[model samples]
Target chain A: MKKNRIFNTITLLSASVIVFIVLAALLFTGIIDEYNGQLLTLAGIYIIVSLSLNLITGFTGQLSLGQAGFMSIGAYSSAIAMMNFHLPLVVSIIIGGLVTAVFGLLIGFPTLRLRGDYLAITTLGFGEIIRVIMVNLETYTGGAAGLKGIPSFSDTGDFLKDSIIKFSWVYVFVIITIVIVNNLINSSPGRAIVSIREDEIAANSMGINVSYYKIFSFTMSAFLAGIGGALYAVYFGYLNPVMFWFLTSVNFVVIVVLGGMGSITGTILAGVGFTYIQEWLRFFKDFRLVIFGLALIIVMLFWPRGLMGTNEFSIVKFVRKYIRKEHEGGSSKPSKIKGVK
Target chain B: MSVMEAKSISIVFGGLKAVTNFDLKLGKGELVGLIGPNGAGKTTVFNMLTGVYSPTSGDIVLNTSREGHNYKSIIKLKPYQITQSGVARTFQNIRLFKDLSVLDNVRIAFHFNVKYNALQGILRTTAFYNEEDEITEKARDLLKIFNLQDKEKELAKNLPYGEQRKLEITRALATNPKVLLLDEPAAGMNPQETHDLMNLISFIRNKFDLTILLIEHDMSLVMGICERIVVLDYGQTIAVGTPEQISKDPKVIKAYLGEGV
Candidate 1:
């Protein structure tokens, strides 16, 4: 057990170092072009969104279609805070997340009682309601024209001097989001959430408060999505009601589903991969969406469990088994026992 | 003193009376059986006792704690709340967390007892690690009791039918209940497995010092294990007595065993 703990710490430290080196290298060398840098930032933001959605729809087994609504709430709230109140970028972003979390609780209270398709439809309606409210609130949200001149991190420090340096902030948020969500899902409360998904009655019998956990998962999902939205607003420097339409919400759900529904690493990979693929397919123009839809369908048909299928990619486990070969004393053959799935 | 008591409890679902004026008094460490034929409201009585169904009119009280205080009414509480109050139950259908490992299936029931909170969990604090280590150790001990330690890492769904039933019981026991309700625990078991289960049930009741309420259709198992039996028919108690007295009752024979038995 002591050895395992040591292995885990080592794996975490090594992974962090690798990520830091990669990001720093990208910034120093300016190897990635502006277009790719923008896509990378977008991927980071999408990863946050997808991970949050996975908390609700994947781990908690609640079909929520209102993620984009929560995202819009965050985007608008943070933009308004920074522009009107002149709050620091970090403070405004946090305010954005808290505000959206409140909205999540409100929507969650009534609609969480409904399950499956009914829940899905109600959340879809809620997303549309958020969009309509954003569009009609002309004084606060600038109505259909959208909110503009949202200050970017480039306005803050030496980050603005180089386009690649701006991605550093996003990468940090992405890491924070991943760590928080990963820690949450691997904990006792996380087990309760998964139990609810497996069997509500069973979960209740085992002394889990089903309703409370459901609301918690939903609220957390919204909170993280709101953070993602704040990042999106700051990165793009603008926000419109149309930018958070029903299709946007669907896009998040698609990302979560195409990644393994419950796999964090899968969602991260899919989020980044999907964003890059969309950018790459820009040449097709009008037919891009058609081809994209076809590709999704084919992928779904081929890998129905999504990319990871309820498995986690654990660096510690990999290191212990492969790199150190701790158990077998440096045997060349692979261990028969599979890792977590 | 009675560990659990229900007084004149009844529930009506719309126009139908599911369980009517059911009363029960379970003494500490007693092994009681609730038996009836099909559709006899056996599971409904268990549900009411566990707070799955709130009694429409009567009171349910539990005096599980060691403190010399008045018995607390539990009818108004939620199922999970009732469990925390020291009443735990197993399902007739064997509701294990199918995808979770057998260890997790049992460990999750210890959620209320674990001393770590969400913040501790997210931060991986010393308290969290200590509590988690403790929980894993306790859960392993529980699985060891059922000789399931070897299969601790196996998913609950992948277990054989008999082991699945055992896992469900293990999970219920992990809650450290004062009153353990077993809902048709021996269902779908072969005679050999049933015999083993009967022995296991008695062993756990003594080992845990638990007041057990058993629901079963098998007469021999109930007769062999239960010190006292309560017979029900169509949401009404037909007889309540020792196994010998219950088997001899005319109403019990007619309602449950038919004329020949």
Candidate 2:
């Protein structure tokens, strides 16, 4: 018991150290300064998109290849809101998410009833349909040229005195999105999602409305992707129809798989990790697709369950087990410290 | 009125007619047995009653409240909705979330009743934790009832065969159904385990105030515990009566107990 408690404590402390070191390196070294505000926004947007993809394909065990299409809906909706209705930035983004969520529901209602491969094909078709519509709708979406001169929504930073208080709005947005997704994946609904993924037949017998939960997972995932798209549009100050391509959706899928399916931490880590890799390996741009494909295949072959697999780390369970074991066999002599026995 | 009534139900699987004009009724706290030979459609009848397969022509009416104010036509409801209307069922084969812990297996079945918002869950709000605690307490109490409290953390797949079957029943009971269905629950049990299962079923029925309908091939187990018995042969009801009447029926004797006859 004593050994287990000490081991758990050490694990937690090491995790905290790793998190602290990474965050400090990102903020203190000004490594992200190289990217323009637009690139940063796109990165943030991909963070939401990739995380949402992880929630569906990773946690829910439902394959989806239509994220790019959902993101396009958000991009076009926000662009139209700003260009036509002249709405504020926040309202437009919210509306964008709502519109995309509705579209998600429309597609999910029918396709979610089918099995994994069928759902994947249906989503892939949906993504292609959205792109085709964008190319055809020259009036609102700018056709081939796409919408331009969109106003910038967020800026880089504002420093105070000796202390460096960097509020990169892009990073802040990404952090908040990550936190929300993290919390959701760890909550009751998250458990439901994971349960459905693990065994649909068992989930149904347990009285979990399988269809309802599946649709909800799909809609929520698309909603986040839409938000990411809107953020990208606003940050970049421009938009184009070509941006929302089928390859973009595939990229998100690769990100989820590489990071580890059904893992919030792994998704975030992979998102940033791949983004840096993509940039660093830009010289070998032709090898980008090759390396990404190989990585996915290798990971699946070696660890078919992904990096974290199905085991979620729980600090509280570890702590309780440790404390119970320590008290089980230890000496029962009264201690000198206050309230000790 | 009976708590559950299945009137003139028929189910056909590609002209095979798996169940033909099958009828079963259950009053509160009644434990009924359905027995038949191989391919006798005892499970088909259970499936029709549970809404897993809708009848070709019939109706299932469930009295959801003591006053009957919340009555529903379960024939029109989906399987999950039927569960919410106070009907739960087990499978012929043990179907469990094999990867999940035993406690989670039960708690997940309690999802329909546990009230908390997605927002509250994401925020880890007080209501979330409170509801979680309540669910844990109730699940633990249920485990204690089945003497499975010590194995709460173990995965469902790691449990012994009898324990796995018990866990499946525990999961079904977690839904708090007014009527529970069991399919071939004693398929692989020894005599000792069979006796224990019989006692557990009786104890659970009285404790939960549940009306149970069980399909089993074990004639002795069925005759021992069931208050009433229904016999089926080739998707048709051959007899329905007490143990004595069923044991003596010539048609049932010909269909299932030819050696004795």
Off by over 4 Å in 2: A1-44, A83-86, A153-167, A313-341, B67-72, B257-261
Least accurate stretch of 10 residues (summed lDDT) in model 2 chain A? A332-341
lDDT for A106 in candidate 1 is: 85
Candidate 1 lDDT, B1-261, residue by residue in tens = 899999999988899898888999999889999998898898999999988888889999999565455698998999999999889999999899998889889888998888888778777777877777788889999999999999988999999999999999999998889999999999999999999999999999989999999999888899999999998888998899999999888998899657766
The number of clashing residue pairs in each candidate reads 0, 0
Candidate 1: residue pairs that collide: none
Q: Give DockQ for candidates 1 onward, in order.
A: 0.54, 0.44
The list of candidate 1 runs beyond 4 A from truth reads A1-3, A27-30, A155-161, A327-341, B67-69, B257-261
Best by lDDT: 1
Please estimate how well model 1 matches the true structure, expressed as its whole-model Cα lDDT. 0.86
Which lDDT value does model 1 have at A221?
A: 87
Q: How well is each residue in A86-180 modelled by candidate 1, as lDDT tens digits?
A: 99999999999999999988887875479999999999999999999999999989999988899988764554244565677888888778877
**In terms of TM-score, which candidate is strongest?**
1
